[model samples]
Target chain A: MDTYYKPEHLSHFASIAEGNKALAEKFFSYYGAVFADGALSVREKALIALAVAHTVQCPYCIDAYSQECLKNGSDLEQMTEALHVAVAIRGGASLVHGVQMLEHVKKSSM
Target chain B: MGDVPLLPTWGPDVAGPGLPAASPRAVRSLRSRGSELASAETQIETVSRVDLSAMPYAGSFERALRENGWARLEPAPIEIFQINLGKLCNMSCRHCHVDAGPDRSDEVMDPATVEACLAAIDRCGAHTVDLTGGAPELNPSFRTLVDALVSRGKHVIDRCNLTILLTASHRDLPEWFAKRGVELVCSLPHNRRRNTDIQRGDGTFEKSITALRLLNAAGYGKGDPGRRLTLVTNPAGAFLPANQAAMEREWKESLEREHGVTFDRLLALNNMPISRYLEWLEETGNLKRYMELLVTSFNAGTIAGLMCRNTISVSWDGRIFDCDFNQMLELPAVASDGSGFHVWDFDPAVLAARPVVVGRHCFGCTAGAGSSCGGAIES
Candidate 1:
């Protein structure tokens, strides 16, 4: 109650399905299928999910996937490297947009 | 054999002071610290004291078994005789369930007990003789015992912490074991240095790699049945190990690619909630959560393949237990008349009739993929 985000809220995530069971079940089913091992290992998927979690800035996904990554045999070094991938992409995304400012300045200048 | 060191040095460089100062969690054994938890009774009380009202299955390992239709967990025919040579380890690992360290040198098995163990191994009809300890190689009679077991034509397994193989006295172990065709089941927490060093001491992963390369040079991990080299891994934290087969594939690739090291197989194990690990769980405030996780993740299918069902653990002093964890807690296997059993009194038929002891810590073996000394019980 004191804060906007309660740590316990992560465990209560399934409760969101109570209002729309079918839709929630479908989404969860897709989520489970997505994480299951395939050509990319479960460990790899967990690391990818971890990187995407950071890119999207989802605290719940970050918390869940951090444990997921560790449980799947990814160490802190690998996790940190995965996080840097997110950082580079996010930074690169912003830096690429600098060309817009550059173009506008050149066009507007005398 | 003439050039090999017959006696362990027990020097500061070889024992207690070898731990790197960077590791804050590394400490002397609980026995040396005079901790109440050093007593098995206190450890049992500590495990039971945790509140589990909100947790699934109420965190009772026995009830979890009963609910899963295992009313009385009984043993299969004995196949492996695991001997705990002593508790005098060179390193004080943070997650060690044995509480073994240099301070525990007083607990090593004497020559008389080693002779008794050999006599028991002869009578017990078990095909495999597993030697374990703080570092089994540190025991003075380790080679003598191994030579005896090998002469009996029993499969010998040295449960080695790889760092011991690099020590001054024990450096020739790889070649010695190779000549005898003894299987080396070494502990390497992770292929990566950071995770491996975090659980063990700093510089451990490098030492482990060097040891593995020595093992490779001596014809281990090269797909030979006799000279099999198996690396065991446990998670560095409170979580369970990942899938064993998958982890083995990844380890094979990484250790080979990164270090050019090779191993025949990998056995992923779960950290048990007892001894030094129990101390860490309590210190880190993860005891309740970890116990809950173990109970909730319990897999009923693993019950039939439980190592205690086929393994008899003999302590350094020749006391017998259903498993190594129980041995650490001082829970001796009892005879039908409720008398404590020892290696001197080992009777395979009598042992096969006894029910395996159950405790809250037993959940460590049953959780998720289910862990045993040999590795994952199922899958």
Candidate 2:
């Protein structure tokens, strides 16, 4: 229960890779590029990031991307819809594994 | 029950002693009866009224505008001159930004101030004159102002709370407004009855539906260019309004199928956290969350189209403000040197050069799609 997972740790995350500057620099540069506006708008990217934040269940990402969604002109209704998309996919992933159960049950019962 | 009026009503008694009939410049403040008296100095009028000095929000709105390339926010040529007739209303709604009610009789604008407004309009040369109040139609000089503006070839907008038309005295308002080519921007909070009644009062939905039908019968909202009827909706609770286009579709379908009522367009507005609405947010323990929501949801694109840039807001007592929200907060329009100005001194050149007076409550206008007197800005 006692760990280094302080809420303030998120702010100090970049410090973790200070000992490995070259790799950390490359990773941050790539992240900055990935979220930039391109074919998909900044709004679209924010919504996508919100959905992924829900799927991964990162508290920091969820907090940051929720504000991101609103800052980019998305409403509560649109944000709720994006979260539901992540929920459906996560639920579907679990349900698809039931195919293995069905195949095993049918073969063994026979 | 059949013969009874839907709501108790009273016409404006302009000859009454409570409202001063002096010229606009002489009437500094229209002090409400049995309420706190305001001093002549406009700046210190309401010292404790919603101070923005220690706002809990983490960011500064001015810094945000600057970072977004707005070195100095300034006004463009004034196109709309909005006049707040007064705060007299039949119904005491729960979420009124004006805090308007039947008890606010003394706050009504006198005929002298109305005349001053017309003179200011001629001087400003603004294309549109927007008349709003607790219910602007309640003003005794409402028709006189409208007729004068129409004769002068100025576009007029009457911000009507639909139920006002169902009252006994205002029954002929629909036909009169339609005849003068006055665009009716009626307020109906929701399509369903529960939300509308909860935010307004019991039977408000029924009366509003009746008023909408009457407008429809008068050729308004029937796709006529001359007779335009637009519905304005604000969220019932502490949240930014849904998208205007999406809500418009839903409102059209539900109103048509259920009540057979129709309107030309739906304007969704975000409820500014001020007056009665701010009290509600504080009571529900949502004031902090709501402030955070507005600050975090700020959109830089809304700056260019902010209504304060294109509109001149004149208060009931002839004091000028940047917007109606500022009027309620007692934040008078200030020059760069920080002196206040009155409506009688309205100069287009001076108005265009003056910087807008803003405070933390401005977050209400910049949040999401952005809100203004004309509903959402971006959409």
Candidate 3:
């Protein structure tokens, strides 16, 4: 109760989700499929998951995916590059929206 | 084929000056049964005459490999040709297997041997050349070897101790290294100053930080294709490292915040209990426990990534070995003629076909996530 999140709480997530058993089963099955090795290796997927975790700012996912990336044999170089990918996208998304500001300035000047 | 200078035998006392010697009974037991002990222990007799009867395990490393379903531990095609340039290092760390120091100048590789090594590399067609030493840069012919390797488009790795880069004569090395596209793998035992200073020496962490800043200014570790910098870390204590990805994140954030230093990656390695580390373990009464820990934590998953499979190790005096650890212990690579092999007699096919020489110390490589020069084997 003193802390908002304990590391042990991560293991209990499945039980909590089980309250809605049918929905939980469906979600878990799909989740398993999403992470399986395909065109991208488990290592590559782990890196992607790590980037998305940072972009979304989820503490839980960040913790989970960090271990996953290492467990899949990805080194620090690969992980750092993946983090930069998220940073670039987030920064680029904001900067690209500046076209609206430019359009508004031209219209007002006219 | 000339008479090489005989290097000094680095005994336990030389490695750690104040450490007490093993008991008289232990020394006698090792000497009296040296042959049987050598066969059982899987390590060659200590060149310095330090009694190894104190080694906790009496079991054979070969037996463990066989019991685990391996016919024999064999080498794969050669890719990385690793050379131990010599034992002349500026800082003599307490746990160095090489027993390297500023006073180890006599052990350096001669130019003729260096040329033979280059010839071997050309013959083997190895894609990478990994150079190590007391401080490899201390070798007079080190730059010449690097230039030769780079000219041949070989990927050269300098296993550097960061503090060495701060030495007066070698100050401009960071720029020289970057221009050649050499992959710099610098050792930094920990991100924090306290642990690093304790393992290496006082003020070492500061010098390492300064050296890292110099490297950063030279465009190393800034996502440049040509300038790659890797930080190597080993635990300061008796345990295996925690997850590497988690540690890398911590290091990246701490270094950037505290020192504004950046590295391309971090490689967390395990401390193998050998030579100086073995002396420390014996003195601290952790020898038995550490051996037990290494043996018990052996993971089958790590075997596929064992560096000995793809790496060929050559010593300063032209002797070749299966790995650097074996090179330190003077265990030659398994040769068909049963004679010691050298860079001059280099043959990749022969090396790949021979079984790797395994000893009890090899348990260090298979424990937990496993360890190699490149870092962990099993993720």
Task: Give the winner by lDDT.
Answer: 1
lDDT of 3 by residue, B132-239 (tens): 987899889999999999999999999999888888999999999999999999999878776676678778788999999999999998888689999998876566
Displacement of the residue A28 alpha carbon in candidate 1, Å = 1.6
Is candidate 1 or 3 superior in DockQ? 1
lDDT, candidates in the order shown: 0.90, 0.79, 0.79
Question: What's the i-RMS of each model?
Answer: 0.7, 7.5, 8.9
Clashing pairs in 1: none
Model 1 per-residue lDDT tens digits across residues B35-114? 88788888999999998867767888888888989898889988999999999999999888899999888999999999
DockQ agreement of candidate 1 with the native complex: 0.75
Top candidate on DockQ is: 1
The DockQ value obtained for model 2 is 0.04
lDDT of 2 by residue, B1-379 (tens): 9988785544343434544432111111123332232222232222224334444344466766777887677888889999999888887776777878776778888999999899989988899999998888888999999999999999999999998898899899888988999999998988877667767877888999999999999889988877999999887667787567766776787799999988999888888877667656766666767777788789888988999888888888999888898888888887776777788776666667788877667888999899988889997
Question: After superposing candidate 1, which stretches have Cα over 4 Å from the reference?
Answer: A1-3, B1-25
At residue B11, give the lDDT of candidate 2.
39
Cα shift from native, residue A10, model 1 (Å): 2.1
Lowest lDDT sum, 10 consecutive residues, model 1 chain B, at B15-24
